[model samples]
Target chain A: MREAVAVFRKQILDTRKNRAVLIQFIMFPIMTIVMNSAIKVDDMPEFFYLKLFSIMYMAMAPIVSMSSIISEEKEKGTLRALMMSNVRPASYLAGVGVYDFQCCLIGTMLMSKTCGLDDGPWWRYLCVIMLGLVISIVLGASIGVLAKDQMAATSLAVPVMCLFTFLPMMAQFNDTIAKVAKFFYTQQLYLALEDINNVKIGTEGLIIIAANAIVILAFFVLAFRKEGLTNE
Target chain B: MISVTGISKSFGDKKVLDGVSFSVEDGEIFGLLGPSGAGKTTLIRVLTGQLKFEEGSAMINGKEVRKLTGADKKKFGVMMDDFGLYERLTCYQNLKVFADIYGVGDEEIATVLREVKLEDAVKKEAKKLSKGMKERLRLARALLAKPKVLFLDEPTSGLDPQTSSEIHEIIRKRKDAGTIIFLTTHNMTEAEKLCDHLVLLNEGKIVERGVPKELCLRYDHQKRIELVTTNGETISLQMDRENAKKTSSQIAEFLKEGKLSTIHSKEPNLETVFMELTGRKLEV
Candidate 1:
């Protein structure tokens, strides 16, 4: 447990060192929210664009942060060094995931504020951010394990992030797409947040969030089991 | 003590290590001398429990290295050629992290950094340090845990001569302090200076094993004798044991005639012995 925290602290320090990560953590959310608001469609409600903006920011954060963890460590050979230290695979993953998840959560908070989401019940907003960040972190960690390098990680993550982002956007346009996007993790978070804003704690909304969390948690465990045992 | 018996490793179809066997006694510096791609690094990795061999077993301190648990792993220190340091971390922080991982205290970190002569630069980030400083920092980290066995693979590969000597001095000190060192180096001089015992590895097999002087004598039969004449002309003679009596007679005649000025016998170095054993030069 102490080793995990040391590794986690190291990752946080490394993230702090990277200027681009800082910008992605801080500026991107602010920029996304401003852009979404500036181009609000005439037929669309104000809250609709804000909700979409929050979901996009939440989804992007995990992919970028998680991919960077593996690629940067692999590049520096830090992962190899850590492996040499005899750190357990589970602890290493937890350390890296926690750091990335923290980044995602921070980004989610900034995006929520920029979208003027303060009027909603605070606990629901917190739950939505937490759920979205966890799912994105799992997906990001899976990508980190699979990608070979920084370029490879980005190349793979861009399409996945785009797909997730586009799924919700597609749901906004077509009822058929909405039905399909309901199966996506971020879509579940989006619906849950929308329901919370309407003060309607629908049983389906609760189930969707709980089910997405369980599935992602299971995938995380499975992914760690598969790729975490071997040191690259 | 570390004992490796008939260990072999292959990546895909290419065999990297082939039935290599050796043992390292406690409190002795054991050198693995070989050319590049001779499986020196792979062999070191296996002994240090960082890699698993396809065949054979390595017993480190009476326990199979491959089967070492987390507690057992903390007893060994390793420094490969690639000293994967965190660039953003200060020298102190880097050492601190490893010390923490090993559950050692801050005093050990200070002691190690001081031993490696990095005390002054402990506060400086790794990326800002020079190459020699980086190597020292790596050495410091490796020694921080007070490991029972130390594995060093080309530990001084890229340093300047002065810095290399400094690093070697620290290694010698460690060996003197009763740490069993498993060292792999292509530098024959390093092997000659530090190794109490050595194994010459060629293509993953032990080609030669013994004390440096003994191996030199066993493989290189012809001795190079250089004599300077009174007229300042130098005469060289290669003498085998069978021809030594005859050569001594000739040298005695030269001395009697007041023609001999200086005399010295030249035995083969580790490099020559290595070439004689492996049929190749140590390339880097």
Candidate 2:
């Protein structure tokens, strides 16, 4: 636990100084706030802009930011230094994931506030979003563990990022894409968000989100088992 | 203590380390010298359990290298070719990461920084420090845990002479404190200055291993005397007993004229030993 916190502390300072990563975290929240208020259209779905930007923030921030942070650590050899210090891979990953997870939750809260969903038990709503965010965090960390360096990490993360971020946003316009995106955690989470407004999260939506979380976590464990042991 | 026996490693069909073996005892500075691509770094990686080996066994502090747990690794400090540092963090922050890892207090961080003469740069971001200072910070990180064994891969690979000398002094202090230092370097002068024993690695195999001077002597097949003339000319002579009488006349001419600035047996250094054995320069 102490080691995990140490890595967390290290990563917090590192992330603060990294402008590229910092921009990723702030851009989404700023966009959600600025755009949601600016686009005052008539007859729009009650929380359409809030929900759209929240999806963008959740899908992109955690995965891209986490993967890039990890890959930067690998590229600069900070990961090796951490490993040499006898830092367990799980603790290191957890530390990194926790930072991204917390940041994304803040974004989620902002979205919830912008949507005025806080009158009820907002913490429970946040918990539901937290569950979905785990999939992104773990998937990002898995890509990070597998990538050799930042460029390779970016190369590998871009497609996965697009698949998760765009597929759902695009699914709104295309029947075929919607058929496929519904199964994705981001899509299912969006469905859950819509249900949050309706005050009734669908059982099937939660099930798909939970299933996606399990598979992403499973991939994280596999990636660590296969490559984490090597000091490379 | 560290020991390895018949260790071998390969990637795909290409072998990188073939039947490599060596041992390092407490207070010993064991240098692994080789030219680029000679598996020196691979040996360090294998010993550190960073890279797996295909054959043989290795142990550090009585624990198997591969079986070493995270707790077991606390006894070791390693600085590799990468010199991994959090460039965005200050020197103090960088050391704080390991200090936290070892469950050490801030005092230890202060001590290591002072030891490496980096206290002045404690607040300086690592990326802003000069190369020599960055190297010092890296050394300070390795020393933060006060580890029993240290694996330094080319610690002075690209430093000015003064900085390199300072690092050598730090390494010597560690040796005096009974740290078993496993160093890999292409600098023959560094090997001779700091290594108690070293091995010449070439093409994934050890070509020579011994005390620096002894290995140099072992390969010093050219038995000759070197002369420096008053006119600033150098002369090399075969120094066999058969030619001693004639050479004495020559030796006396320079000695009598007081131009024999320096004279000694023309012994080979580690570079010559490396060349004679592998036919490759230590750093080409």
Name the candidate that leads on TM-score: 2
lDDT of 1: 0.80
Estimated TM-score for each candidate? 0.90, 0.94
Error of 2 at B207 (Å): 1.6
- Scoring only the A-chain of each prediction against the true A-chain gives TM-scores of 0.82, 0.92
Worst 10 residues of 1 chain B by lDDT: B74-83
DockQ of 2: 0.76
Second chain TM-score for model 2: 0.96
Alpha carbon lDDT at A180, candidate 2? 91
The number of the candidate with the highest lDDT is: 2
Which stretches of model 2 miss by more than 4 angstroms? A225-231, B257-259
